[model samples]
Target chain A: MTNTENAPSGAEIRLEEVTKRYSGTASPAVASVTMTIPPGKTVIFVGPSGCGKTTTMKMINRLIEPTSGRISIDDRDVLDIDPDKLRRTIGYAIQQAGLFPHMTVAQNIGMVPSLLRWNKKKLAERVEEMLDLVGLDSAVFHDRYPRQLSGGQQQRVGVARALAADPPVLLMDEPFGAVDPITRGNLQDELMRLQSELHKTIVFVTHDFDEAVKLGDRIAVLGEQSKILQYDTPEAILQNPADDTVAGFVGAGASLKQLTLLRVRDVELKQEAITARPDETVEAVRRQLEERNRPFALVLDERDRPARWVHKRQLAQASSLRTAGKPIGDFVSTQSTLQDALEACLAEGGAAVVTKERGRYAGTIDIDTVMATVQRLRDEAGVSE
Target chain B: MNQFFEFVGQRWGSLLFDLYQHGSLVLQCTVLAVVIGVGIGIAVYSSPGGSAIATALTSAILTIPSFALFGLFIPVLGLGVQPAVITLTLYALLPIVRNTIVGLANIDPAVTGAARGIGMHRLGVLTRIELRLAWPSILAGTRVSVQMLMGIAAIAAFAKGPGLGGSIFSGLAAIGSKTAVDRALAGTIGIVVLALVVDGLLVLLGRFTTSPGVRARA
Candidate 1:
């Protein structure tokens, strides 16, 4: 087992003019798609059905042989390795889950480990760990058969089984597509959380662009017959769509799609902040800051230069205490992403204060920042009319 | 009424008495024939592309004049039950072999893929998945073969084997109404009962063991 500790920055997945043609076909199913996927990042393949997204994924593990071109994993050529060995090293998940009907959940998850001839104790431990990793209770599900499980439960088991050996690379073909929308969201969230922790190089194939945008670190927007339209982050693709096909896929609400992708830097944050004098009564400050929902109330020195941050928490606490006089200064930045800004405001009981250099008072971000971020991201994403 | 009572009281009385006398011989022959026929069926069915060859061979065996085939067997294996049992057994193979091939071939490819993907090797897959799924069709074929065996066992008595057919053959030689009609009727009725019983048993077995999916579709 090679330690990926110094694993060369990002996972370098390279395809040099890769193409696949079935025995009878005149044209390649996947035409010379040469792309590189950065390590520990998700690269999504998006296109219509039969456009060879699936074929391209399978070629990575040699489930389907590529007619031409070389594929390199890390730095080694993959064609020289045995197919089964290569597949075992690469975790594979499919749309149907494809669990064996007769096997128990534990045995199913333990398949690759057992194939690798792992010790009984080690295999058993791995199975339990995987079941827990997929948010399934190992005790409840270990002994149950596949037939006893529901579609969503079975899909979790499928993920568990693929990840049983803890392979560094994962290839998923619409893994959550079979589940209901609500369950799909839950699974996607779970997968995202897992990816953050494990950092496995992932190649995901899906026909759903929304799912692609939701999950992909970088998406390869593919056109008919496996043409690479654009390979970019969801933000970049939304902001500067390559063509009508790509724009159409981002949909009529491309602006809304941008909100999903755009970070806090793309939205404006107030830099200058108004301050209340330190000697001012808490009541006076309350009257100034209450219901207005500013990110912070700044405490000023005698000259009214930047002093400290008076977060909304101090005001709310002061109101409860009925204290006459107090200085307020403790808050987070307004420049954080809407997610962080919203969290900070909520943390300070509906309004967070910001601090600039050396704890100097700065403006805050509230729900208004969130709305502005959404609107700006939408505009920048190219919403016509 | 007096004549009927006298007939009942006599040592060799009704058709039932005649059937009872020779039933063991036919039962023995049927059992041995089934075992031999099933073995041949398995062997031939498992052979690659042996279906057509086996079917033609069985068809030819059925066509050989039954009494004449018995006579030919007697010259080689001597008289008595051996020749009769072997001939009847050979006749039972066609249906069983044909059905076995059909059963094994008809399993779902998707199910097979699922089995293989889970790392079940060849024999494990065959026994646990394919063979179990194909069992009902295979049993149906065996039922047809067993029913045919019951009807053919009576003809085996011609070669001095003690079957119900012996009584019929004896009656034919005698050419007299009194014993001939009684003997011939006894053999015919026994064969019908045997066929009915075997077919009924197989039907019950099929119901008990067939998969719910297969049973519903069937």
Candidate 2:
């Protein structure tokens, strides 16, 4: 079957004046903060420790019920349903993976599905699919226990287990907080790829602002006692933070960080660069490149995708463009972030080739334009340094 | 020694009967004590006040000498297997109850939190997650209770309770007789054998029932 055909859409979650008060604490752990989490989007709650960011996220799933406030999902009140039954329909993954040590990886992933009363055969197949989705091989890992797995692998199994039942709303509380930085980056990228496909309403909580910028479509920067300091898209937060705390939280390199929020397709591609078919004569391509006053001619293959970069100097040694110059060193897709494009330009030594659908030749993106975008962001934000 | 061997050979049938009776008494009481202890443990383990009370109550019962406990039971329950069973079972409660509290308390909060977060009902968490993880510690408690009851059961003969305790008590009563030492020796040896055998079985039970993931690794 097709992937997106069965992709699960999420339910919108609304919180109205939710507050959690612990007795004798003299103050509510989470203040009377309210916000709506749109369906099929990743919203992050980011703040320093003891900021109650996690408490706000948990209130939606009712793991820690709100002391006062009305919480609803898709217009139905959450307090109306039983917490256990509601939890069954909400995916949850936590730090250290929170995997049960007694159960094997297969059994762990199969936990939620089996609880939802899926039949034996379907549950087994779903567990396998989940393991595969999390990049774990079932044949090797299925019968293995959690202790047998590495930290990152256990975290993958944790995600697989939470997703086994395919709940529409997924709540992740610092799921990658326990891993080393290198593995954490890889896990974050993997989650981004997964979210692009799953499109589940995800509420992710993290203390790290960089992680929030990378993963969240909208970020909720909370202050002490769970006060909502700012709520906006990652771009808005990066370019124009609502307050000094948020700006400080976004930290230095806010403009460079904004580059990650913009994709290659969002920027204008340079079409003045000359291009020639691989079947063309090297002299003809050189003449076109010289006439255009461009330093190089991009050679395209039959499908019109970039195949080689023929410099006027490199083209002189070759007779045919097909056999001419060096192979295309680096290219960025329209979907690739500008930071990615910047990296590609560095690898290519000048212009980075950009492609659209089916890797068809789009145009070129250079380092200067990316720097200009950063400066433009700085100017718009009214900040100079 | 020659006289003791000859005396043992002569009364082998009765000795075997006493041994069987002794083993049965300890086994049944141990099981009954475990059920009661675990039930109390599950009930009170979550609250410090309740755990302390149950543990203190059971430990107080343990402080009463087995003979004195049997004597005290005679006034209320009035003798025979009833007094023996109740007293031994009550005595068995301390280790099992204490261990149960410790076992239930020692579970990782993350594991229980995960269990609850994933939609397991409270009872489901208790029976499936809590009980399963706590099994090894509970079973260790059960083992301690069983070993203890083996020696204590000999005192059960004070109430005419079944077992090798009957032979040992009678032999003690006839202390000046030539066969007194042999008779007492037979009963004492029978209990020691039974304790070792039952403990071995419990170890086997642990191996077969415990998840290897949780079992202690060398």
Q: lDDT for each of the candidates? A: 0.72, 0.89
* TM-score for chain B considered on its own, for each of the candidates: 0.80, 0.97
TM-score of 2: 0.87
On a 0 to 100 scale, what is the lDDT of residue B207 in model 2? 95
| Model 1: lDDT of residue B157 | 73
Task: Estimate the overall C-alpha local distance difference test score of candidate 1.
Answer: 0.72
Which ten-residue region of model 1 chain B has the weakest summed lDDT?
B3-12
- Supply candidate 2's per-residue lDDT for A182: 93
Task: Name the weakest run of 10 consecutive residues (lDDT summed) in model 2 chain A.
Answer: A1-10
The DockQ assigned to candidate 1 is 0.10
lDDT of 1 by residue, A251-314 (tens): 8766555545544445555654546776777677777676575656666666544455656776
Extract clashing residue pairs from model 2: none
Q: What DockQ does each candidate score versus the true complex, computed on alpha carbons? A: 0.10, 0.61
Chain A TM-scores for all candidates read 0.73, 0.87
TM-score of each: 0.63, 0.87
Model 1 residue runs over 4 Å out of place are: A1-12, A262-367, A371-385, B1-218
